[model samples]
Target chain A: MANGTVALEEKSFYEESTNKYSGILSWLLTTDHKRIGLLYLVTICAFFIVGVILGILMRLELIAPGPTIMEAQTYNTLFTLHGVIMIFLFIIPGLPAIFGNFFLPLQIGAKDVAFPRLNLLSWYIYVIGAILVLISLFLPGGPIDTGWTFYIPYSVRSTTNVSLAIFAAFVLGFSSILTGLNFITTVHRMRAPGMGWFRMPLFIWSIYSTAWIQIIATPVIGITILLVIMERAFGVGIFDPALGGDPILYQHLFWIYSHPAVYIMVLPAMGVVSEIIPTFARRTIFGYKAIAFSSLAIAFVGYLVWAHHMFTSGISDTARWIFSLLTFIVALPSGVKVFNWVATMYKGSIDPKPPFLWVMSFIVLFSIGGLTGLVLGSLATDIHLHDTYFVVAHFHYVMFGGTGTIFFGALFYWFPKMFGKMYSIKWANISVALFFIAFNMLYFPKFIMGYMGMPRRYFDYLPEFTNLQVISTVGSWLMGITMIIIFANLIYSVKKGKKSPENPWGGVTLEWHTASPPPLENFHEIPTVTHEPYDFSQLEEMKHESK
Target chain B: MNEDKQNKENHEHITPYSTYVLVWLALIALTSITVTVSGIDFGMVALAIAMLIAAVKSSLVINIFMHIKFDEPIFKVFLMVSLFTLVIIFVLTFFDLVNR
Candidate 1:
């Protein structure tokens, strides 16, 4: 592959694109999208582990009612930190900040995102925001214990350093906005010669939709967080009821962004599934236009359902029912996606790789999560299950079970391509199995106990709920072990795994046309698409070229 | 390719100084209208009138000063999508508040 001169393919991205810096400075200051992606991957994974440990500690406290592992105040702080780190530090940036940065340009046949400098700036802003959140923990006011929602009256009055933490979130919102702007520009201006809108990969479509949500919805949260910071730092009557600010209005503002923000978390996961299902099934994706358009539909409908979270929070009956109807309406596009994925797999050659297995699990678990969400979306059922463990279980099944699984699913599918090495497939399979079982055990019992009237965010429970609590605690332990094994398998592979063959899975996306751990600029020559995305007839040609 | 065509359409616009001056004058006049309406106290409609004038002023800046007029049609579509999202949020929130 190497000629007399330095071609982009002669050196892998790891050894190329230094941007004139060397050593640690090369990484910290590098504007290479791939390197910056790895930067986000490492940081986000660290926050994920921190969030997981906080969760395990919280579960330990609930193992036996009444001061089992810590004080009630300590329990309050733990759950708050868990939600904060998981949602903001981990999942919000989980897929887009990492894989989207790495693969979006590659899939679109662009050398890099439209604004490479702005892309790197997004990562730096993310790091600065993360640091601010961490610094707030040790500050004099104490850790933010208002839960991730930072619901006001309490958020405004809490003695903890809520202002700094909310300020951190405000800064993170900037990173989200800038990243979104970069992707939109990239999609609009940098698509390859023959890559039409319909010819592009579904992952690009989903992330494109997610970028719009990030641009449109994130600023709302940015403004809401600033208001909380101001009301706390000074006596601004914005959110505090005592100061004549409406607490309900705060709920309205918070959910307006945070609800659509959930789509920001899941839309890309859905896109990843759309990519993987067809590759494993060896078929063109069914209803390509339908899947693509549904992404936009989901984003548009997701905005109207924000008030569903505020259904029980003193919102008017008209708003509650209308939002409830819209919440149910949002399920239509998700159903379209799930249907298309399963249909694409029908009567096609299917390979049950770890990535495939993870998504298969995602289909079942996320369905349960989305369907159970309807129980909450119903105005009456929500009033009953509003703050209970049922609510807790519902989101976890969707979020942790949904996006969280696909996050790793994508990592496994693209791991070899990203690192030029393959993970231990046997161990990867075992880890996914353990994860599925452990995850169900941890959250499933919450539904039963919650129906029996157990509320969330509490350290103690009735003696009758003790059995399920113990099961949940043990499940958390199992989940902790499974995570460690998955990391061991992946971390070891990053350094010592066997070399992966090009087009290892015979994928047909634009990214697969190039070398594994592709060169700094991604391709030896830019590809001009002539067939639709996921046309499996191209697989044989890719296999021939790779060899 | 479509992207190339779009690129060709971009970075080629040259707005005359006269256009900028006209847009700026229109903005200033709209601002005075906003202030004038606020003083008249048209009750609840006062805020709506001010917002309407502000919207007109912004369209002048967007179309002329910002050069959206010279850009491809796709950019105008993008602007509309963003504004549509904002309008939906406001209308939906007002539904709750007005009913309450």
Candidate 2:
């Protein structure tokens, strides 16, 4: 086949117009999965840059104990805006919408998602949500001052554009639900001949499991957001204490979705690590079934442990004990995954590439996040750590350090295949080194100062926190500067870099078998699978040839 | 593909009109029972009974009107899993509420 498809180079999705539309209109109106994936990649990365800038600014303000830059209300609005934009616009829809939408069909040996037009519609919905958030900032009452959680009463009372902002989140959740439904149906019915459940990639498993959480957990956030809007609009008193409604109920409903939403964020990143680890290690995956099932286990147990976020919010002791136990239980499956990834690397000819290096950082940082998570998970320690920077540092470690690191890894891992371009591996490694060092300097101090009683989301702190705050602030600048190098390298390479080989990573997955920047239909003829997913022995002739 | 289609066609379910009427009557009867139970208020157990009735009514709607009775086993598995997850959420949420 011509580069794993019957078509010529002109038939690739990036080439001349197959559809009538071309240029910007082709992009907007096109339903091609790869194009939509690129669209999302650009959009979310733009939002990520904005979020990072806001974060750097926030740290700049906090560098001094007193008001360094903005007013207290501005700081409040800034963090809220930062949280809403990052959570709703960037990360939540990020890996799944970008990678999952792009690769789910490709990985499963299908031409496109089960519903192509619906796939496009979900993207439109996501864009609509992003637009709504942007418009809210300029609206009459100003942007939402409540955090992304939109804890009620405060949300109801806040004199900001809470309704419109939260309504955007509701719309975003709808997009997630549709995408979940599409992926689940695609996986169930659209696998190529002989590509059974076990034969699918671990990334598909993670995405599939995440699809369930999207379908099940996302609706709770949707409902909670609507309740917040309703209470704000009509004095519904659903969550207002002054009107005899319960505030705690809002926290419960919010985290019920948001907590599992963390799994939604991290699981696909885990799936990426699973794909990268085996490829770089030059070995068969250690425990494919174990990792696959643990994704599901984490998804399920993740749901049952949402109440852990509410431990200090006046929930019952029964709830505290029950949720604490469930929290520990959820950690088991995550540990299972970390164990399997390490085992996969054991004794293999490790490549030490950019992606693998990111995974190495992922293991160390995610484990720190996970281990400290146990401290936060316990009833006694959480009492000490609750609402402190410890909690903030913990999530950033897990979410940003872990999932965020792998985000870079997956980008680099797939960039060659996606763009048919290769950048300097040496430069990529330099960026990763700076990224890890700056990341630790930024968040690790918060863990210590947090334990010593530094509260989260404050305008001013005691004099003692000043030094650590300055270090953290300086670290943010380095990390922000490093991001420009990393992203600029990739973007420049897309136009001018060397043409990547077809199977650049010697990946045995369906995506690698096809051309770099595969044809519009993904494959000319969907190939049948007769072997295991990670059976490297079958691909001896396909060993990676470095460019 | 044709054989699978034929098998699916052969297994297609068509409930009798009388069966639909019977389910409708059962739903009505359950709704009446829920109303009666609400009036007599057996405290905590009453909420459980209400949910149990709601569950029965929905399952009837699912299996009969939704045609899950003649659908593939996987559909049934999905339905059961969804219901079980719903129960888990409710029980856990109420555990906090009641204990508090």
Candidate 3:
């Protein structure tokens, strides 16, 4: 390490890099990515708990037939809180902020993220957004129930805290944009010497693509939400139908960002799975370049297909047809990734570790989700499914089944690396299995109920749908219990589980080359990466041939 | 090694603040022209002109202030793909709007 002095200077530059902060002051003022990531991890876990409780309450009210828990407005607020917390707080930051922050610099063989201070700032902004939304709940008019999308006319006219909710959204979008900007710059400028563009890991590529989506698409939604806030606060008539403005225009603007926002949420999870599968499969990913390129393709095409959500929002037949076609086209890249994962698993030495099990389940559930997406992409079909439980089922299939599975899978994959501890494989498997079954039972019935013409957001439904709703409620409770078990297992591991090896899973990536939980600066000497990422064969060859 | 190379590339760079100013003035001029032209009765043509002017202004801002003009070619590709996708959304929605 002749350039050890350069490394030393860099280390002193980030003097507090490796050490765990002690006092409240250290925790508050730290700019370390690992600390910031831990901050997000704790915050989002709290939000997820809140959201799940809201979800449980919503389900309980629908358990019998009528208002069992609270009034209709209360129910509306409950679902709205559930939607806002789950989306903006829990899922959007699911992989990127938690795992990406923890691993991106290490994976790229760098000291820290491109802009570590900006990373800390993004977390603060996210917290501020949550506070804003929470404060809105206590305002003179109750919390907003415009269904997260906050479509105007309804949102503008309602006396609820529309301004606060939209402002919170504006702040959240900024947080997302800063993260994207950071990742994009980091990938571009901070890679090791020999790591070429295509040589980077698929997870990095996926986040890179997602970052672009965050940068470009987020601003549009920021402006859209700003206009909504203005309309609500100052009597501006941008999307107010009574003021010669088109409410539909607000829908148009909102979907422009919100549609791509879902892509932002899922793309990083897909990246995480791409990393998990090949490592566990003991094979180079089939069609690695295609999978990497497809990430960008998906993000690119994701932007074009926003109007598919609005097909029933009354644009026009021609627009609907065009959107339908574009939506189907967007499905191809995702399909490519799925096919490649399956192909990688074929005839390979697959390790059925818990992470791999979750990745396998992600492939299955994500397929169902992606296929159902095609159904909604169809104009004629969407006309029937829009705002129904079918739409709800589709989103859950993707977010819960697709991204949710990956979130857990990433936790398992990176847990040892992040905390220097190994979770119980037996319990992890049991809980994932329980979750998988409950998840399908819960959402699968929604598809049937929705196609049978049951609308979503209903406090009371037809008596015939009562059986399915009860079944869904049972499944929801089961999933909630499974989540509790999984969390307990992880917490138990952190406290008493065996200390993990630096490269416990035999992962060949740069991340495993560092100490468990990583050094504060992540690396001692900046690695001059000279091989393709995920080249497990090279590592295999380097090991002794004999036992 | 690439960092050193990049450092070399950037060191010779004259500050582009003048370029930024020039582009900003051009954007302002084009927007004013578009606002003035909107007063004429050209039906949908006015909308077309306004959007065109907007497109030009946005390109200038993206190119100069955003540093896309001096960025790596890969970033330009990413930007172009995003812009192309935005066009797809706008065109498809317009089709829906027209059909309505």
Candidate 4:
């Protein structure tokens, strides 16, 4: 129970590693989890920026309807790259790869992940996969215009570098698998003595559930993408209708993995929300077991509902009904999580920090996303909304509004701990406000346009869709400015901000027990756990100590 | 070092070498039986038989070769959950195709 002990003599993780290699090589070749997490951080941020730019370009093209900024082919490629970079590189790996890698072991009172070298290898594989994607962009036939899904027949027939891009995704899938393996092993074997499964932080539970999906569901995408690459390269005839392969079969295979991949992206974000809520509310989490078990329940039910994405793909009525039923079922667990979070904050001394604000926005935005998902999950309504901008809006509400907001919140929550400096809270809150407003403005119109039958992935829209499109584009510009402000505030704070103490927000987790910007090995002496995670008495004790 | 020793003690389970041999033989026997059954025109039943044999073989590999039998109950539970998920996916997907 060594909570809030100072190890002033110990060097921070940034200062050195056990490895003899110094400077950049220490980062590049090190097996340290914190360093590797930072590696993932820098890499995903670069990709996220690239994705945002591609997205803005697509929005610009759509702003005025016909051929505003780029030609039809360029627009197609831009959207394709935008989806690939965002889904595969940024959002899929966003929270888990960065924050989970850095914080999981720290929170569990372990020195590093179970397979530290394997952790480093996953980052390397991630870079290699990312490089392959970039290389495909400049290849002979031009970047793949096949959307990130790489739906069959078109993917088979496209002369572009679909094979390379698909292969890039395949490599990325392997990286995902290894990371999942590392996390699962770490969680199973690396918890501190006396830290039973229930005693562990809810964040660990969410990450564990996500890891299960990653290992079990990701291989389906790996094999599916390889089949596409094979079909493109050698006419394997697996998905090509002309070649006796069923296109719907391809849809089945893709969603089998891709749908679960959605949970992979959002489940960890939900875990972040759980962590932030209890800390800010200054109370033990409400329904801790319910929230923890709901994560697994989501992962379980999530796998069964991938076919909901195929409702318009001419799937059987039985399949559609069953999947639609499962889709609604999946929503129950998510609803449980949301309700539990709200209950946790009930009548508590809520610290209205930037991170908590983001969590509040997450509850609103993700609820909108989740509720509209029910709209799309219903077979009757999905037929009308399939492939429309409504679908696009629903997705962004969930992915960007839900996961993206939480990612920023987690960064805000942990920034002081990770960097030993506090960012400007005023600027942080201002950026979050602008971001939330601009985000809704940007994507909310899509719900209207989509319901009005505005088809997505189209280069031109009828004049009726013009005004809403314009509003969305203006929102994108605001988003761009917001991004600039947010990143600049964080970047500037790293070098010049006030130094953070060991427990900045009075967090009760094991991570708060150690130094901010913890040592390379994460702890001076591995702590033995005695209390349940989010136990408020620890926070009360720390507060008294400060006085 | 003490933690490492404790972890090793927790996870290291040594199965009898003869058990692996027996599981390997069973897997091979199952595979050959499946191959021989494919010659008969039992139609859909033949496919079911083949799958049944494959399932048994996999369980043997998982439980014995993978040491889930001797290792931890949690490992076996997760293994079952993973397989159950695969089954649900297949059954649900076919529900659409068959009904349509």
lDDT to native, each model: 0.90, 0.88, 0.83, 0.90
Per-residue accuracy of model 4 over A70-173 as CA lDDT, tens digit each: 89999889989999999999999889899999999998999999999999999999999999999999979999998888988788888999989989999999
Each prediction's TM-score versus the true structure: 0.96, 0.94, 0.92, 0.95
What is the per-residue lDDT of model 3 for residues A1-547, given as tens digits with 9 covering 90 to 100? Answer: 0111122132321235433665665656677777777788888888988998899889889898878878899888788889988998899887888878878887888888889889989999999999999999999988988787777678877889888887998898889899989988899889877778888889999989888888988889888888887887786787876788787888888888888889988999999988998888888889999999999899888888888878777777777777789899999999899889889888778889999989988988888988999999987788888899999999999998999899899999998988888989999999989989999878999999999999999888889999999999999899899989999999999999998865677677778766666667777777677667877865553232111
TM-score of chain A of each: 0.98, 0.97, 0.95, 0.98
lDDT (Cα) of model 4: 0.90
| lDDT tens per residue, model 1, A258-314 | 999999999999999999999999999999999999999998899989998888788
What local lDDT does model 3 show for residue A148? 77
Q: Which stretches of candidate 3 lie over 4 Å from their true place?
A: A1-21, A540-547, B2-7, B15-45, B48-82
TM-score of 1: 0.96
- Fnat, one value per model: 0.68, 0.68, 0.93, 1.00
lDDT (10s digit) by residue, model 2, range A393-445: 99999999888898898899999888989988988999999999999999999
Q: If the candidates were sorted by their DockQ against the true structure, best first, what order would they fall in?
A: 4, 1, 2, 3
Model 1 alpha-carbon miss at residue A21, Å: 2.1
lDDT of 1 at A15: 84
> Per-residue lDDT for B84 in model 3?
78
The DockQ-derived docking category for candidate 4 is medium
> Which of 2 and 3 is ahead in TM-score?
2
